[model samples]
Structure formats: C-alpha cells, structure tokens
Target: MKPRPLDGITVISLEHAVAAPFASRQLADLGARVIKVERPGVGDFARAYDTRVKGEASHFVWTNRSKESLTLDLKNPDALAVLMDLLKNADVLLQNLAPGAAARMGLSFEALHEKHPRLIVCDISGYGDNGPYRD
Candidate 1:
C-alpha cells in the first residue's frame, strides 16, 4: 500500500454539522487518526437532523465518516480531564463549537500551548472570533 501523508498524525475533533466534521474527515482520509468528540447522550445534534439514508442522518454520515467517535460531557471535570489527556498524543485539535466555548473549556490555543506546544488548534466559526455577530 502507498504511504499516506498524515499516517502518523492524530486529530482530536470537537465538531458538528458540516464544515468541521468534513474537514476532519478529509484529514482521516489522508491517514490521520481523527477522534471526534461529541456530546454525551444524543451525540452531535446533526445526527438527528434527518434519517434520510437507511436510518442514518445523511448530513452526519456524509461528513463524519472515517473517524472514531467519543462521547464526552465537557461540563464534567472528569470528562474534561480525559480530553486533556487525549490531547497529550494528538497532533491537532479541531473544533467548530460556538465562539468562546472551547476557550471556556480550557481548550484554547493559548491555554493548551503551554502543555501541547506542537499541537495545532483549528477553530471554525461562522463569524470571526470577535465581533458583534459572534455568539
């Protein structure tokens, strides 16, 4: 088999809907280990968007393929600690959470840089990090 460019890279994704998950799926396609962190219970809300594909949400299935899924309730300290531990070996952290949510959870670039200096942090937001429309 041909070697993939991202064979040794690992991506930890806290994402949903379309954009971020699709991006992570791309990384996974390139041979990265993409671990998708989803909310507990219902997982990504997009999973329930509609069951158009044999009892699965087409939107979620389209974007979330080729990745491993993990359920974590970030509001809980134990779950947060588990995520932080996972970051220890992750090469990238990708999130499309509401603006400031990741930072509030101590997953911001600034907050994590000290510990995971080599880890790349990607935050996807509709609006820029700061603006009247940011929410």
Candidate 2:
C-alpha cells in the first residue's frame, strides 16, 4: 500500500452544495486537514436536504469529515476578511461557488497566488472556467 500524497497539507474550502467539498474531503482522506466553510445561520443547505441516514444528511456527511466546519458569509466584508485570514494559514484552497463568484471574490488561483505563493488552489464548477456554460 502507498501513502496519500497530501499527508501534511491543509485544505480550506469555501463551498456549498457538493463538488468542492467532495474534492477537499478526498484530500482529507489522504491526511490533509480540510476545513469546510459555509454560511453561519443555516450552515450548508445540504444539511437540511434529508435525514435519511440516521438523521444525517447523506450529502453533507459524505463530503465532510476529518475537517473543521467554518461558517462565513462571503458576501460580507468582515466575513470575507476573516476568510482572507484563514487563507493565510492554508496550504490549499478549494471552492465550488457559482460562475464568476471566484473571480468576483478575487479568490481565483492567480489572485491567491499573489500572496500565498506556495498555496495550491482548485476551483470546481459544473462548467469549465471561461466556458459556454458559464454565467
């Protein structure tokens, strides 16, 4: 058997829905410390989807584990600032926000790279960046 490559990395994800969280958790499975960020009041909406498995939302539990749960409203300036602080300590950043959201938030790989030169960023979306499906 071989060890997972991201053993010592820490992944911080600004996510909702599924895709990005799914990816970060895989990184966590390999020993990375993944943090899943969501809105404060409601948390991730997926948590309310259905309590099918022992009162747990299948989607939320599946993509989230061995990670910290951070609640931040990206739309708010203070919250965004807090997220920036979090980025300062992260080795990797993951997100699955809507089309243009990453760029709007300036959380794109290039933007983040300017500060954390060694940080790895991954943006997951239904469509590719600059694609026909983009909004």
Candidate 3:
C-alpha cells in the first residue's frame, strides 16, 4: 500500500455550484477529507438542477462523491459557531460563494488568518475581491 500526499489533510468547503465543488472533489481524490457545507433544509442549489441520475442531480453526484456533506445556515449564530469550530482544525477552507458573499460572512482570508494562521483559505469568485465591478 502507498500513502497519499493529502492523506491527513482536512478540507472544509462552503460551496454551492460547480467550480468550488469540482476543486474540492480533486482534493478528496488526492486523499484529503473534504467536508462540504450546505444550507440547512435547502442543501446545494445544484442538487436540484435536474433529476437525471436516478432522482439525484447528475452534477451533484459527479462532484460530491467521496466527501462528507453538512447542512448549516451560516446566518444562524449556532450554525456559524459550529462552522467556526470545524475551521479550528481544518487545513483548508474552500469557497466559491457569490461575489462578496464570503467576505460578508466574515470568512475573508484576512479575518480567518488571524485566528487560524495555518489555514489555507481559497475564495473563488468571478470578479476579484475589490474593484468597481466587484458586485
């Protein structure tokens, strides 16, 4: 047996669509533990894109395998606390939320870097963090 490079890494992803999930899926494939955070009761929007895979969304099935899924409403204090606890030990935090979404939730790299110095925060957005068109 061989040891994978990411065998002990823990990835916590605040993702909804394809891009972030795709990236995290690759990490999981490399042996990282990927935990996907979704909205409670709603889950990921992509989950309802279509019922092409035996009642499961094809896109969801494709990128969500080999990972754990957790439902939490970031707006809820309790839920946010739970997520914060998870981040305490996570090696990476990957999010492809809407522009400014993560920042609005206080998940910006700068904010988290202070607490989790070693945490890698990857924010994927169509537009860069700041600029006239960052909306």
The superposed Cα distance between candidate 1 and the true structure at residue 98, in angstroms, equals 0.7
Global Cα RMSD, each model:
1.2, 2.4, 1.9
For all predicted structures, in order, the TM-scores are 0.94, 0.86, 0.91
Better of 2 and 3 by lDDT: 3
What's the lDDT for candidate 3? 0.92
Error of 3 at 116 (Å): 0.5
The prediction achieving the highest TM-score against the true structure is 1
lDDT, candidate 3, 84-129, per-residue tens: 9999999999998888788888898998999999999998865666
Question: What is the C-alpha local distance difference test score of candidate 2?
Answer: 0.84
Which stretches of candidate 1 lie above 4 Å from their native place? Answer: 131-133
Worst 10 residues of 3 by lDDT: 125-134
TM-score of 2: 0.86
Cα error, candidate 3, residue 132 (Å): 9.8
For model 2, residues 1-135, the per-residue Cα lDDT tens digits are: 677788768888888777787788788988888888888899888887899878879888887877889788889999999988988988988888887787798898878888999888888886777778865
Better of 1 and 3 by lDDT: 1
Off by over 4 Å in 2: 1-4, 130-135
